[model samples]
Target: MAIRDWPEGERPREKLLTLGAAALSDAELLAIFLRVGVKGRSAVDLARDLLSSFGGLRQLLEADRQRFCAEHGLGEAKFVQLQATLELSRRHLGSLLERDAALTSPTLVRRFLSAQLRHLDHEAFAALFLDTQHRVIRFEILSEGTLDSASVYPREVARRALARNAGAVIFAHNHPSGVAEPSDADRRITERLREALALFDIRVLDHFVIGDGEVISFAERGWL
Candidate 1:
């Protein structure tokens, strides 16, 4: 049966409107994005099939254009729409960071950083430059490397911090290997960066190591 044929309270859109988006299943949220289904399937049914074929929602969202477009019930238009939606979500999270003190909103900071870096197949090193009041001055991906490691230079990081006139910075890097534990190299480099930036009166607030579903913080572990 079509989505419209379902009881009003049972409908994906109606249920979202009534209970809230968090109340919906992954398939239901995706069905709302799909808007309509092909041939005999309802939108929710098509969404479930797509999610299964893609190996779940994250895999589907991270799929390349060709792979995503090749799926049944999806094409260029849907790819464009999906990319736009993902970017909008990232920007919204970034905007929230810009408006708040980075230190005070550690959860938001982790979320924003996770959204920015977690999808990459390769490793990336990023920095969040903060003003005197600890508001975000800029967020930048300093370098990207192979799946295992990214080369981070203290001179380059210092240059950017000076350029941004940052009073403090929070460093982050992703382990594509999905291990949030900070390697010894991670600690050494963070210490080097902290020392280098201190010469310019800039503080290194924290270093975060992002994994698949976990984020490890240097400050939280009293490493800083």
Candidate 2:
């Protein structure tokens, strides 16, 4: 049956309005984005088929233009819309972080960093430069590398910190492998960054390794 034919409370849009977005399943949320379905399939049914084909929501969202457009019920228009939506979400999270001290809102920091780096197919090293008050100065991606490694230069990091007149920094990198565990190299680089920044009176607050569904913090592990 069409979504309109279903009970109003049971429809994805109605359920979202009533119980909130968190109450909806992945397919339901996707159905709302899809808006309509082709031929005999309902929007929810189409969403289910697309999710199954892509292996899950993340894969579907992260698919390249060619791959995403090749799928049934999707096209360049949908791809553009999806990308815009994802970017808006990231900017919203970033705006929230800008309103508070980074150290005081570790959860927001994690969410913002994850939103920035998680969707990348390759490894990326990023930093959140902060003022003496520990409020964010800026967020920048310093380097991007292969699927597993990104070359991070302490000197370049220190230079950026100096340029920003940052009092402190929180470093983060993403592992495309989906394992949040800090590798030996991760530890060494973070330590080097700490030592280099210390020379200029800039503190290294934490180093975070972002992976699929997890973010590991050096400070939390007592390593910072």
How many clashing pairs per prediction, in order? 0, 0
How well is each residue in 1-224 modelled by candidate 2, as lDDT tens digits? 99999999999999999999999999999999999998999999999999999999999999999999999899999999999999999999999999999988999999999999999988889999999999999999998894222478788889999999999999999999999999888888888889999999999999999999999999999999
Candidate 1, pairs of clashing residues: none
Candidate 2 residue 121 Cα shift, in angstroms, is: 1.1
CA shift of 178, model 2, Å: 1.1
**lDDT per residue, candidate 1, 8-54, as tens digits?**
99999999999999999999999999999989999999999999999
Which residue pairs collide in model 2, if any? none
TM-score of 1: 0.96
Query: Best-fitting candidate, measured by lDDT?
Result: 2
lDDT for 7 in candidate 2 is: 94
lDDT of 2: 0.94
lDDT of every model, 2 decimals: 0.93, 0.94
